[model samples]
Target: MAFNGKFELESQENFEELMKSLGLSDEVIEKYKDQGKIIEIAQNGNTFQARYNYGSKVITNDLPFGQESEFVSFTGHRVKALAKLEGENKLVITMEGLTAAMELSGDKMIETLTNGVSTVKKIWKRI
Candidate 1:
């Protein structure tokens, strides 16, 4: 779905570079990059999931029985990971941390929460 990489050597430049590679119009990428949330995604697919901080606030997660749905929308779902807001950390899920979190909310979320240390390991492997 997505290749794991960081454009952090130069946040703005690297963001521009990665966005260009992702086929975004220069105008589109510039909007978000200007705000400094470089790695955010507006959409996703079945094989992949994405995470972004919302308003730098936290939310409680809830779940339903077998909470499966054809569409998992989070517009009103303002929950975000503590570190995501700082942008000092980036999470690129290789296995299923991203997968599990998207599936189960509430207490099951951390099981899907990206492993910060493990993620750094994966990033190191790619670099």
Candidate 2:
């Protein structure tokens, strides 16, 4: 259950809706939908760091299990998040009004995000 790899987005469901619900501007959503994003993650023991890159812009987060820390949302908002490992390959994160889970199975990574109002699914492939 090693979470050290570069992942590229393969498909997204309700991405625009989720971005809009998260207060992202229409222009930003349009650009994101067209370009997509890449994520690189590294995990060491109980510590995790993830880098998200979209063209020239990049965001990084370092998360420790079960601890509250500041993390940047997709919309660039600094939010509080608590992350914990579920079993071997699933990483569950809870933020203010939102919950996200990322699971690595075989060669794919499946991520789900929910914020009460809407749910978004993002599928990624290892690179």
Candidate 3:
């Protein structure tokens, strides 16, 4: 089970930090300031969908969805980076292209996050 809600920070500093933590450069933030359009839509009047928008475009994970690596790992098309809530704020981080088990009952979402980033770094060769 996962708790899905819209998480936004109320501080300028923390808000910038949140974007930075998600891998956006300072300049990028400035350009996209107030340009980030996130929407949490409802499905079947019972489920929610969280998505980020830039201008008129929507960002997505592009990970492949398969059963083999579905649990205990994060991967696939339509797969996206992860956003987590830390000590005092909500953070958006790249899913690192890893698909780990959905930690439904854990506050330490970063644990699963690291796996994706680590795997991405290790498997990709610099060209």
Candidate 4:
């Protein structure tokens, strides 16, 4: 899939539950509860870069496909993630204990995050 555009958050499912499962504090949860994020994905060959805003912070992750990359998680933990393309339209990223499966269909991007037990679905629309 060619993920080279900007996407705005359309909807998110089980957000609070997913945050709780990730061991986020109540205070932290309440702080960013209603805040939505906009993400920009830029891909060139096997190199990938994704930029997103978290609160007042702008986080960017740059990595290569099929390689291990370290990034700071939202919960303030350092974690490793391996990103790869699955088929023609799916982008899969495997993190510590979680997997993010992203698919681009038309002008919408659907991302499903699974942490073994709990799963959260987030949808973003092209901007």
Winning candidate number (lDDT)? 2
Q: Give the runs in model 4 whose Cα sits over 4 Å from its true position.
A: none
Rank list by lDDT: 2, 4, 3, 1
Worst 10 residues of 3 by lDDT: 118-127
In the range 1-127, model 1's lDDT, one tens digit per residue, is 1222311111212445544554558777655454423222222222222333334532223222232323222223222221111122222222212222222122121122233322111111111
Question: TM-score for all predictions?
Answer: 0.27, 0.90, 0.33, 0.91
- Highest TM-score among the candidates is held by which one? 4
The sequence of per-residue lDDT tens digits that candidate 2 reaches over residues 15-127 is: 88987897778998897775546899998777778889867778899988889999996557899999999998999999988899999988899999988888999999999
**Candidates 2 and 4 compared by lDDT, better number:** 2
Which residues of candidate 3, in runs, are more than 4 Å off?
A: 1-13, 44-48, 60-94, 97-127
What is each predicted model's overall lDDT from 0 to 1? Answer: 0.28, 0.86, 0.33, 0.83
The digit string of per-residue lDDT tens for model 3 on 35-82 reads 533332222222223444555766433222221211111111343344
Winner of 3 and 4 under lDDT: 4
Better of 1 and 2 by TM-score: 2
